[model samples]
Target: MRTTHAHPIAAALAGLALLATLSGCAGSTAARSDAAAGGPAAPVPAAAGAAAADEKAASTSEGTAYAAPGASERQLARTAKLTLVIPDPAKAAKELRGVAEGLGGYLLNENVVTEQKDGYYVEPSTVTVAVPGTKLDDALDALSKIGEVRNRNVGSVDVTTDMVDLEARIASLRASIARVQGLMDKAGTITEIAQVEKELTSRQSELESMLSKQKALAGRVAMAPVTVTLRPPSVVIQDPNPLWQGLTAGWAGLLQSLRMLLTIAGALLPFVVLGVLIWLPIRVWRRRRRPNAPGLLASVLAPATVDAEDVPAAKPLDAPRDRPTTVDG
Candidate 1:
């Protein structure tokens, strides 16, 4: 026998072929076993292909979810309250509306009151507008230009963590949806199918709800809201009817006078009491300190006494009585 040596390339090819055969056999056996066990009997390759498709869809949704975060690194929502005093309210209101519209913002709320004070109506004092976050500063400047800004408050809320968490949740939900869909596909019995479908439906609803929340959050982050308040100048009301006005004014003045009097009395009452308490003790102490000083209370309440040195001497009536008595004896 001529020594027959196998070529290395041929040996490698044979090994690969044998391995493929064994893999196919094992795959077939596994499929049959799964079918007997009332599970998915699809070939492993087909299942892998489906799984690949699901992952691709999941990845697509993940990309969509992250798009907002990439655009909103700052993720700061801003709001402001403004108090302005304008000369002409109607003109000022119109100007404010125009400014909001020019900034590509819309008035979320606009209210006008027809009630007039003096001769003119007070334009709406409250105006709520929503503008792009980038345009907020410009909008505020334009609004300030319209009139003198009495009060201006600017506030910001950082939502970076919230937005980031929302994206992560969305990605997780997409993955869960993919898993449920895979379960739905593998379900063979009607009961299994119904159960899987129910779960899938519930998950899908939650996912959609989360999507809506994400959309709203993203919108708020992108657009900033600035409120421009147009305050009309102060006006005094001049009623045409003066008779009733005079009567009411007189009554009001009387009541005001009484109130002021009562307020003064109330304020002075405590001090008066305190002074009386203090003066009583001081008077007592002063009288006790002075030797000759009689108490005012003693002079008013006690009877006066006379001393023996001040008594008058008996008159000669006593001597005459003594002489008459001796003669009679």
Candidate 2:
């Protein structure tokens, strides 16, 4: 009976040990998997490491945020406007185009205007071109040799911050897209797969937009825009003598007065012709009626003649005979 009791106790003890061993192995395996998946197995260390990484990234980004004072790494978009008075605007414009091409640039736009000046056709040109940002000063210098610069303006804009922001966002979107793709691969249901795919598509679209903006911004920083306005040299007449100046002024005034009078006459010519055309017909009509008018006037003004027996004979002495009979009575 003691042997039987010992056997049962030993079996129970062995089973318990085996169960404990199994539990330990499972716990270790789970802990390793959680660590590999960056799960909550070691939350405190992971959090600390993440914080350190974030601080490091922030410090590095801040350090490289801007270029040094004179460094060329700074992204700048440069533009210049120049007004030049040259002898021949057309020729100058052609030369300017060649200059831009020589400097590895291209013309963006050109407008040539032909105007009449002093009985001569003058062609003035306005040209816009782009050149390498580094060669902007050189281009300006070369252009200055083409003509006398009457006006000049140079401007610059910094886009480093925008470029940096775009780059960061693009990187983030790429990582997010990759993570979503992984999730899609692991998805068990159609709904989860569709949702992951939709998220991926959205992120990809955002990434593409950011890339486009970045490319445009980079192009602007790489090239500088220049606008050149070329005009013909003005003619200046110099007369030092006061008498000659006075005579010239008087002649100019007389010519201006004559021009004004001619302009007034030209404006009135049509109205005057219209008035004469209307008056001539009326005058002709009145002349035709005047021949009949005289007869009507004669009929109205002539004295009327009375018939011979129409007048009664005047009484001669009847009044005197009546007065004498009254006196005798």
Candidate 3:
């Protein structure tokens, strides 16, 4: 009976040992496989080390800021200022307005001015058009056909990074607002609730401001503005007939001379009137002093008389003759 008990105990002990060894082997195998698949298992560091690493990563990412790095979704604000020589600016303006309307665009403003050229009035118009960004190229192409381009300036600004950063900031603010609101709802005290509400309002306002900015940026990106200035052709045709040319030239010269004379007369009229007012009394006083004054017209045309002293006097001819006669007798 003692031998059987001893044998049972020994077998039991061996089985327990065997089971422990198998479990150890399985654990080792799993560790080895994990090590092979992933990198070697590092000894777990203290919590402080992990925290520092996280902080470093956050700082690096924040410091690097956001960049649009060759992305397919690019935001560009396109604008163009163009000057062109069209045969007729009024007609061109009309056609351009039609084109803009056809392209689901509109003319923001327009002005047409008639200028004199080669004895004819040439109309030059300036128009500002707002069009969908997608149709900007098409509109430019069509407008180009209407005239010879005198000046063309096209520009684009990349706003991808700005837009992305704004979106991220807005999302973060919204999340903050939500969190604050949740805290407000769960607050146990009036003070806590008030504090949470204050923070929530701040974050909400910030979110709204960011959203407004986003809308503005999107508006610029969605539509493009183009300012087109249409000028008449540089060289204008003239009348070949000499008589007609001479007549027009004479007429222009005459009109210009008349205009200049009228300007001069207008400018001098004030001074002339002032002079008459001041001089009339002075003239009247001088005439009273003289008592033998000529009329205004006679005074203007009369030749000045020399005084007797100013003229050399003739010698005393009678005294000379008396002396000469006595001498001769």
Best by TM-score: 1
What are the clashing pairs of model 1?
A: none
Our model 2 lands, by Cα RMSD against the true structure, at 18.0
Cα misplacement distance, residue 262 of candidate 1 (Å): 34
Candidate 1: regions farther than 4 A off: 1-67, 70-72, 120-124, 235-329
What TM-score does candidate 2 get on C-alpha atoms? Answer: 0.54
lDDT for predicted candidate 3 compared with the true structure: 0.64
TM-score of 3: 0.50
**In angstroms, how far off is 176's CA in candidate 2?**
0.9
- For residue 217, what is the lDDT in candidate 1? 80
Model 3: per-residue lDDT, tens digit, 68-149?
A: 2233579898888889887766788898888888888888889977667674456668998988888898989888887898
Residue 103 alpha-carbon offset, candidate 1, angstroms: 1.7
* TM-score for candidate 1, residues paired by index: 0.55
List, residue by residue over 271-326, the lDDT tens digit for candidate 1: 99999999999988987899665566678879978998899886656443444445
TM-score of every candidate relative to the true structure: 0.55, 0.54, 0.50
lDDT of 1: 0.65
Regions of model 3 farther than 4 Å from truth = 1-72, 115-124, 235-329
Highest lDDT: which candidate? 2
Q: What are the per-residue Cα lDDT tens digits for candidate 2 across 1-329?
A: 44433433333223322322332233344233323433322122444335434643553464343321123357888999999987666788899999999999999999877676784446667999999999999999998889998998999999877776665554444433443444444455555555556666766677678667777887887789999998887767775899988999999999999999999999999999999999999999998978788888999999998987998887776554454435555
